[model samples]
Target chain A: MSHSFRVEATADRLPEANAGLDAWWSGAGLPDEARFAFELVLEEIFMNVVMHGSPPEGAPCMVDVILDRQGDGVVMEIADDGLPFDPLAMESPDTAAPMEDRRVGGLGVYLVREMMDTVHYRHSEGRNRLSVFKSIGST
Target chain B: MNVNIESTEGGVSVARAHGRLDFGASAEFQKALEGAVGAKPKALVIECSELEYVSSAGLRAFLVAARAAKAGGVGFAACALQPAVKEVFEVSGFSKIIDVQADLATALAALA
Candidate 1:
């Protein structure tokens, strides 16, 4: 089964996007860990599109999200009509740095990678597409 | 997210965070923590028993608060993290940088 929804590329719309996923997951009957991974990865990638991939020309950007059940796991596909950017290509932050030397940002993409089993990014037809999948039983 | 900050008689400020701590709530949560730190308490302990979720943005808020507490010479700790939030903390290496305890009593005792 698959569920689809769209949201404007803005920080304010993040809660709506999250709500859509929450509503879908309510009936999906996935384990608690898998649900947490899905929610975290969705927030990370969705915010990336809103914060970094928005167009510079002030055009309205839109993000389309699809949650699909594959086998015993789930796959999420997020496509945004914004600037071309690959979150996977971004450098991972130094998670080992001391608090005083640590930077505040840059952990979002890193967390997404750590939580999801597979992540793929592609830019085609003027859209940036990101797909993330995680097995329900793997935690 | 709802954050309630109160100071104990021992000069420890306990900030209870309830609900999801995501990007939408990060700025507000950061401000609240910074405010608690600004009061110059001997220590600050975040009670997270009711905090259902935390995203990277929420982690950023914790980072900022920890930095502020350090700069201000206030001790800091977080306790009773939900399982999922704890996983994110460990994955981000926040468990190494910040003091984490099993419960509110332990967090307060550690700061003492």
Candidate 2:
């Protein structure tokens, strides 16, 4: 009910987050599909923080992850303080086209939105908070 | 992840890969693929049954491999893809240009 946790948004912390989340997921008996979804969501969020959230050169963006177990899935709340941007408001890339024809960026976030069951975004108090939820199969 | 290399029948070289193929694997996968293609292997099989993840960087490495194979005129393909890994291929449109099959038998038959 109160599985609150926060992590800094840094490439180095990616492995730690993945391991910690994997442990939490396995402990909760989430299915492999859900695990993949969670990882994909995490990657998209992390990349956004790294590539777009920070300043042009780069800045440290703190990522706070609060995990809550839902009926049959887990809801993850992520907040970033780098920029005041809305992720859910972004349009998806054209997956219909070939790779060479497609744009280079935005595909990660687009794929994350497409895969996750629910994605919500909010900008409040100079922070971008993203809510992501995905249902997992029984392990 | 584990990678193994061996020679197929008629002296064709085949390299098999297991587990996730991602940025973490770029170096290993690139080296192996390059070596195999450099040796003039008739075909290369990237068995993706255990591969779980692939980022843009990983896809870039695969693209490099594809380019190399195409340049060298050596057959290259992947087989036994898990659904997740296969989805990455689909999202990137790699399934169209690269050789992809549902099973090893099909891949070998095609590549052979």
Candidate 3:
């Protein structure tokens, strides 16, 4: 079973897309830990597409989020059709930099990696899709 | 996310924070922190023990609070952040600008 939502690549719609996942989780009885993992990773993935996905103001893309219980673990896949960029390749934000010296962004992706059990990305069909999985017991 | 806050007779305000501190909640967090500092408290203590996660936006929110408190001649300090969150503060070098403490009691006194 899978549900899909198409959203414009914009920051304002980020939360809306997230809420869809929350609703799905609630109905499926997803645990708190797994829920958090999905929220974080999805935010990072979705926002990246919004921020850098298209022409900075191009057409919105479709996101297909599938929530299925795979042996007590939940699998979430995020697909975007704006641009071809993989978040896993992005450099880690420099924690050592002073406040004034630190880059303005990039911490979101790093934190996502820290909190998730597994993350994978692939660019095909001119779309970037990322899949994340976490065991329910991990929470 | 909920912020548990109370003001002491000494004019000090302390906030107990629980939940992930990220961009999603940064707006609300910034508002609450500013509201506390606006009361002209002598000091501010942020209990972050229960605070799960924080991003750079979270750090910016704290900076906004600190800057406001500084303008008011009061002080601000953050306490007991989770290791991962703490690492973020450390990575962004927020530890240097924002005074981080081991516990609420310690943060309260740090301003004294």
Candidate 4:
């Protein structure tokens, strides 16, 4: 089964988007760990679009999300009509760094990469498309 | 997220966080934690038994608070994380840089 939705790329809309995603995942009877991974990954990518991918002219930006359960794993695809940026290309944060030397904000993409089984990014037709997959029982 | 701050007799400030700490709630949570650190208690312990969820944005709040506590010469630790939150911490390697105790009692005792 697959669930699809669209959300405005604004901080204020995040809760609503999360609520909708949670409701769908719950109804689908996903395991607790799978649900948690999906929630975290979605939030990471969505917030990145809201924060760094928006246009400079204050144009309205929107993100499209699709979540699908395929056999023993789940796939999530997020497409945002924002700047052409590839999140997968970003450098991984140094997780072994000491607290005093660690950069505060770079851990989001790194966490997403670590938690998900696979992540792919593409920029096509003026949109940033990111797809992630995770097995249900891996967690 | 709802963060209730209180003080122990040992001058440790314990902030208990409940509910989801995602992108939407991160800013407010960060301010609350930073405020707790700004008070300059002997130590700061975050009680996370009731915290249901946390994303990377929420993790950033913890990072900022940890840095502030270190800079201000205050001890810091977090305890009783739910499984999902614990997973996030481990994957992000926050369990290394930040002090993580098994429970509230252990957290307080470690700081003592």
Those runs of model 3 whose alpha carbons end farther than 4 Å from true positions after fitting are A1-4, A98-100, B1-7, B15-24, B31-42, B47-56, B63-74, B79-103
Q: Which pairs clash in model 4?
A: none
What candidate 2 gets wrong by more than 4 Å, as runs, is A56-59, A85-91, A99-104, A137-139, B10-12
Candidate 2 collision pairs = none
Candidate number that wins on lDDT, 1 or 2: 1
RMSD of each: 1.5, 3.0, 4.1, 1.7
Task: Put down candidate 3 lDDT per residue, B1-79, tens digits, no spaces.
Answer: 6787898766779998898776678889989999999888898888898888665567778878888887788888889
Worst window of 10 by summed lDDT in candidate 3 chain B:
B84-93
Against the true structure, whose TM-score is highest? 1
Pairs in clash, predicted candidate 3: A95-B91
What TM-score would chain A of each candidate receive against the reference chain A?
A: 0.92, 0.85, 0.84, 0.93
Q: If the candidates were sorted by their TM-score against the true structure, best first, what order would they fall in?
A: 1, 4, 2, 3
Residues A1-139 of candidate 1 have per-residue lDDT tens digits of 6899999988898999988898888877666656888889889988999888877778668999999988668999999989899999988889899998887567898998999889999999999999998888642
Evaluate every candidate with DockQ and list the scores: 0.88, 0.33, 0.31, 0.86
Instruction: Specify the highest-DockQ model's number.
Output: 1
Models ranked on lDDT: 1, 4, 3, 2
lDDT tens readout by residue for model 1, B1-112: 8999999999999999999999999999999999999999999999999999999999999999999999999999999999999999999999999999999998888889
Native contact fraction, candidates in order? 0.94, 0.08, 0.19, 0.97
| Residue-by-residue lDDT tens digits, candidate 4, A21-102 | 8888888877766688888888888888888888878875899999888767889999998988888877888889999888
lDDT scores in order: 0.91, 0.72, 0.75, 0.89
N/CA/C clash count, model 4 = 0
